[model samples]
Target chain A: MQKSYLMAPGPTPVPEQVALRMAAPAIHHRTPQFSRLFRETHEGLKYLLQTENDVLMLASSGSGAMEGAVVNAMSSSEKAIVINGGKFGERWGKICEAYGLEVLWLNYPWGAPADPAQVEELLLQHENVGAVFVQACDTASTVAHPVACLGKLVQKHPRTLLVVDGITAVGAADIAMDRDGIDMLLVGSQKALMLPPGLACVGVSTKAWEKISQSDMPRFYFDFQKERKALAKDTTAYTPAASLITGLHEVLAMIRQEGLAHLHKRTELLARAARAGLQALGLELLAPAAPAASCSGARLPESLDGKALVRYLRDTMGVTVAGGQDHLEGKIIRINHMGYVDSFDIVTALAALEMALHRFGQPVKLGQGVAAAQEILLERYPS
Target chain B: MQKSYLMAPGPTPVPEQVALRMAAPAIHHRTPQFSRLFRETHEGLKYLLQTENDVLMLASSGSGAMEGAVVNAMSSSEKAIVINGGKFGERWGKICEAYGLEVLWLNYPWGAPADPAQVEELLLQHENVGAVFVQACDTASTVAHPVACLGKLVQKHPRTLLVVDGITAVGAADIAMDRDGIDMLLVGSQKALMLPPGLACVGVSTKAWEKISQSDMPRFYFDFQKERKALAKDTTAYTPAASLITGLHEVLAMIRQEGLAHLHKRTELLARAARAGLQALGLELLAPAAPAASCSGARLPESLDGKALVRYLRDTMGVTVAGGQDHLEGKIIRINHMGYVDSFDIVTALAALEMALHRFGQPVKLGQGVAAAQEILLERYPS
Candidate 1:
C-alpha cells in the first residue's frame, strides 16, 4: 500500500478535520449562519495578522490579492517601487506594469533579500512613489524579505504604503501587521493556513484604505472599498468561496486554540530542524542568511540531478517536494516546514532525502540527517 | 430534525458524489495527475458550451469573468452597447464604465428583454462600437434575452464582438456558442453546473480573441490572453481553484452522461412547471414574455410581504428560495428550476410557498399549484 505525503510549500497537507469541515454540505452565503461564520473567521484573521485593520476575504488565489493590492492602493499616475527578489517579487512588478503604473524595480539576486536602505534611497529619489511591494517570504527561493525593516522605511513616506505578500509568512512567521507598519498584508489559504488554493485574505490598514479611496484605478471584482463596505455588514461584496471559508473557520479555530505565539514557535523550530538536517548532509542552503520559516531550500551536489531526485521522491516514494525554478532548476530542492507539519514530517523528509541520495550513487549515511534533525526537534518535548 | 432544501437560483445544491469528490485530499496543482484531470474537464466544458473555442477557467466568481470580458474584448477608446434590462444586465454597463469604456446603455424595464432592433440601430450609429454586452439569462429578473437574435445583428459588424453572460443559461438553455455567433460566453459553476461559487469559465471565440489582442486595457488577475496561453498547457495561468475544479470535473461528467440536450430540456420542463404552478396560485410571472429556464420569478400580492413569505418558507418550512433585490425587494419571490433539481423539488417549492402564503394571511389553496405543476411535470416520465 502506498501513502502519499504532501511537503510542498503552498497547498500543504490539509488537516483531516479541516478537510471534513469543508466537505460538509455547502451553505448559502447570504444567510445568518454563513454571516456568523464569516464574522468569527474575520476576527480570527485579525488575531493571526496581529492587526486592527479590516481583512477582506476574496474568492481568488494569492496572485489575485496581489493584484488587488496594486490596483487599490496606487493610482496609475503614481510610481511603484517593486523589490524583485524571486518569482513572486517579479510578479509585483509585472502587476504594477500591467496596471499602467511606472515601476521602479530594485533587482536582487535569487535567494537574497532586498535591502531596505536601497528602497529608502529610491523613495527619496522618486517624488510620487505611491507604494513599495515586496514579499514577506518568496516561496520560489524560500527567502524571507526584511518586512519590518522595509515597513519602517516606507512608514516615513506617508503617501507610500508598504504592501507585503505574506502568503507563506503570515501563519508561520511572527508578523504583527500594525507593529510592522505593513499597510497591506496578503495571505493565501493554501499556504500556512493549511487549506486548499482558492481563498485569499488581505489585511488592509487604515493608511491603505485612505489611499484606496482616492485611487481611480480600473477594477470591479477586486475593488477593495466595496469589499471593505461589505465586510462591515459581515459579508463579501461578491459570492465568497463558501467551502473554503467554511474550512477557514475551522482552521482559524485551530489556530486560536493553539495560540499564535505557539504556532509561530513550532514553525520556526521545524524550519530550524529542516535546515540542520540538510546541513548534516553537506548541502548548502539556498538562503542561508534570510531563510523563511515557511520552507527551506538547499542546493544539491553538481553530480546529482535535483529534478530527477524530486521526481523520484514524488512518483516513487510518494513524497512530494518542490524543485527550483528558472536558473535554479535541477540544482535545488525545497521542503516545507510549516502548516500542519510536525517534527516527524521533517525527519521523514530528511530520511527520504538521504535514501534518495544513496540510491543515486552518493555516499550518504541513512540516519545521519535524521539524527541531526532529531537533536534540534527534541527541544519541542521535555529535556 | 429539519432537512433543509436549497432552491436558490445559484449556489445550487451540489450532488453528493461531486461534493465527496471535492472533499477528497487536495492535490498539488502543478502535477501530471492534475493536468490530466484539467484536460478532461476542459473537454467536458467544450462539450457543454458546444464550442471548439478556448474556454478559460478562472479562479473567481462569475462577476470577475464578467469584468474580464469587458477589459479583454474592448478598449477604452471603443464604445460598448450595454443591454441593461435587469440587475445583471445593468452590471454589464457598470463594469464597462469601471474600465473606462464608453457605454451606450439600452435601458429596458426590469423583467423585459432587450430588443435586437434597438441594438442593431445602435451598432449602425456608433462607428467605433467594439462590443455588445448582454445576458443570455439575467438572474435577477429571470429574463432570457434574445442572444441568438443579437448575435445575428452583431455578426454584421466585423469590429463588434457579442459577449453573453450565460451564467444561468449555458447549461440550462440551448446556447450553442459557435452556431449563435457569440464571441464570448461566460458560465458560473453554481447555477447549472451544480458546484459551489468561486469558479467561472469563459468560452472565447476566435473573433473575441482578435479583439482581445488589440485591446490594451489594464488587467492582471483576469487577463484572458495569459489564461489562454496556460489553457494550451492544460492548466490555468494562476493557481486554479483546485478543489472547485475537482468538483467541476465530477459535475461535468454527470452533465456529459445526462447529455446537454436532455439537460436543457429537463430545465425548461421544470421552469415551465414552476411558472404554471405560480400562475395557478393567482400570482403574476416576473418575466411573462421571456422567462429564463434557469429560474422562475413571480410577483406577490401587494398586501403580503414577499420578504416575510420567503423567510417563513426558509426558516419555518426548511425550504430556501430567493427574495427579490433592489426595487422589487419586498414585491417578488424567485424559485430556482435548474441544477440538480427535479419535478418533485419544484413541487416542494410550490407547496412551501402555498403553506407560507396561507400562514401570511393570503388565500393560497394547498396542492392547487402542485396539481397544476404535476400536470406539466408528468411529461418527464410518460408511457
Candidate 2:
C-alpha cells in the first residue's frame, strides 16, 4: 500500500496524537473544562512565541487574522509601509488598500528577500507611517526576511509598529517576538503547528494595542478589542473553531515537550536535506539567497512543467507538494519541510521528484537525489 | 473512571465514526481527490436538506451563514420582518440591523411560537418588505415555529423571501424547503449533524439568488457569491475548516444510512421520552405549546436553582446540559437529545436530574422519571 504524503507549506501533516485529541467527545466552550484548556493553550502559545504579549485566538484562516491586524491597528487614511516580496507579502498591501489605508508599497521580485535598509529609508521618508507589514517568510517564494533586522529599524520609530505575518516562519525558525522587538506576530494552526487550518493566533505587543485603541474601524466579527476583552476571561469573542483549538492544545503540548529549539533544528535539517538532494540532481534553487526553513522552492528543469509534475507526484506517487502561484506558475515546485515532517519526508519528496523528472525525459539517475538526502539524514540522526 | 457526556443543544455529541474520519491524514484542498470528496459532500448535503438548490459550505459557525444570508439577500435600508421568539431569532434582527436594514420586529414571548397571521398582515401592509427571517426551531426557548405556515404567507408576497435558520431544526425535523416555499435555509455541522462547531451550509433558492444578485452589501469573508463561484469548482472561496468538513462527510454518510425519516423519528422519540420523564416528575415544560424535538426545556421547581442543578449534573454526574439565557436564567434547564444520541441518553439525563433534584432537597422520587422514560423508549424501539 502506498501511503500518501502531504508536503504542502500549509495544511501540513498533523501528528496522530494531535488529530486524535480532536476526535475525543466535544466539550462546550463555556464550561470550566474548556476554560482550563483554553488557558493552558494560552500559556503554551506564549511559551512557543517567547513573548508575554496577549495572543488573541480567532476562528478563521490566517488571512482573517491578517485582516484583523489591519483594521485593528490602523485607521482609514493612515499611512502604512508594506514590503511586497511575494504573494503573502503582496497580501499586506491589498488588505491595507481594502481598509482605506494609504499604503507605501516597497515592491520586490518574487524569491528575493526584503532589504531592511530599503525599509529603513522608506520609514524615514514617511515618518507618519503608523505601521509596517511584512512576512517573516513568504511561503509563495520560500524566502525568509530578516525580521530581527527590520524590527530594529521599526523600533527606532516609536510610533510605527512592525507586524510580522509569521504564518509559515514562526515554529520553523526562531524569531522571538519580544527579543526581536516585533510589535505584532501572526501564526496559524496548520503551518508548523501540526493541526488543521482554522485557528489563528495574533500576538499583540503593548505598543500595537495602543494603536488599536485609537483606531475607529467598522468591525464586529474580527474586532481585536472585543476578542481581547473576552480572552481576559479565557474565552473568545465569538464561538471559536473549538475542535481546531482542541487540536491546537495537543500540538502545543507536543511543541512544549519537544522544545522550540529542537523543533526548529529538525526543520532546518529537513530543509537542508531537501536542498542538498535537489541541488545534487542539478536543479536550480528558486530562493537560493535565503530559503525558508518551512519550505524550499526550486525551479523545475526547462523540459518539465511544474504543474504537471506536481499533479503526477500527487496522483501517481501519492506524494503531495505545491506548484507556484500567479506569474511563477508552471516554473517552480515548493517542497515543504515544516510541521510534523521529518527527514524521511524529504527523501520521499526527492525520490518522487527524481522519478517524475526521469519520466518527463530529463537526465536524472535513479537513487541519486535520495542518496544525497540520506547522507544528510544519517549524519544528523547518527543512529 | 467516569466518562463525561455532552448534551448541549449545539455542539452535540459526535459519533466515533465521524471523529475517526477527521483524525485521518489531511488532504490538500486544491487537489483532484479533495475536489471529488467536496463534490460528494455537496451531493450528501443536498440529500440531507431534501432540496435541489446549491448548498454552499462555509468555514465559520452557523451565525456566519446567518450573516451571509442577511447581507447577500437584502440591500441596505431594505425593510425586513424578523420573528423574535428566542436568542437565535433575536440574533436575526440584530444582524439585519447591523447591516443598516430597517427591521420590523414581531416580538413573541420567550417560549411562544410566531403567529403566521401576524406575518401575513405585515407582508400585505408593508409590500416593500424584501424578506422575512424566522428560525425553524429557536434553540434558546426550545420552541419550533410554524415555518410551513409562515412560508405560505411570505410566498404570497412575490418580493418577500422566507429565510429559515434551520440550524437546530434541519436534521432533527422534516422541513422540505422546496415544498414549503422557503427561499433560503441554513444548517450547521455541530447541531444535529454530529460534528463540531465550525462549518455552516446555506441552501439558496433561485428566487433568493435573484435578490442576492442585485443586492449591494459590504462583504469579503462572508461573500456568498464568491463562495458559490468556488463551490462550482468543488472548493471553497477561502481555506475551509478542513477537519470539521472531514468529520461532516462521515456524519452525512451515517445520516444517509440511517435514512432521514429514521433519524428524525429517533430524535422525536428521544425528545418525547425526555419530556415525558421530566413531566412525570411534576416539572412543567418551558415550551409546552410547541416544543422542539431537538431539545426539551423544563422549568425548575420553585425551590431549585436551575443553574446550580445544571452545574451539579455536569460536575457530579458527568452529564452536561444547558441552562436558560437572558431573562429565563436560573429558571429553566434545557435537556438536549440531538445528534449521536439515543433513548439511553434520555434515560441518563432523567436519572441524573432525579439524583440532582434529590441532592438539592427537592421531592424527586429516584426512578420515577427513568421508569416513565423507559416505558416510552420500549414502545419506540422494541427489539
List candidate 2 segments past 4 Å from native.
B1-383
lDDT of 2 at A136: 93
Question: What TM-score does prediction 2 earn?
Answer: 0.52
**TM-score of each prediction:** 0.52, 0.52
lDDT of predicted model 2: 0.85
i-RMS for every candidate (Å) is 27.6, 25.8
Could you give the TM-score of chain B for each candidate, in order? 0.99, 0.98
- The runs of at least 3 residues in candidate 1 whose Cα sits more than 4 Å from the true structure, single-residue gaps closed, are A1-383
Worst 10 residues of 1 chain B by lDDT: B374-383
Q: In model 2, what are the clashing residue pairs, if there are any? A: none
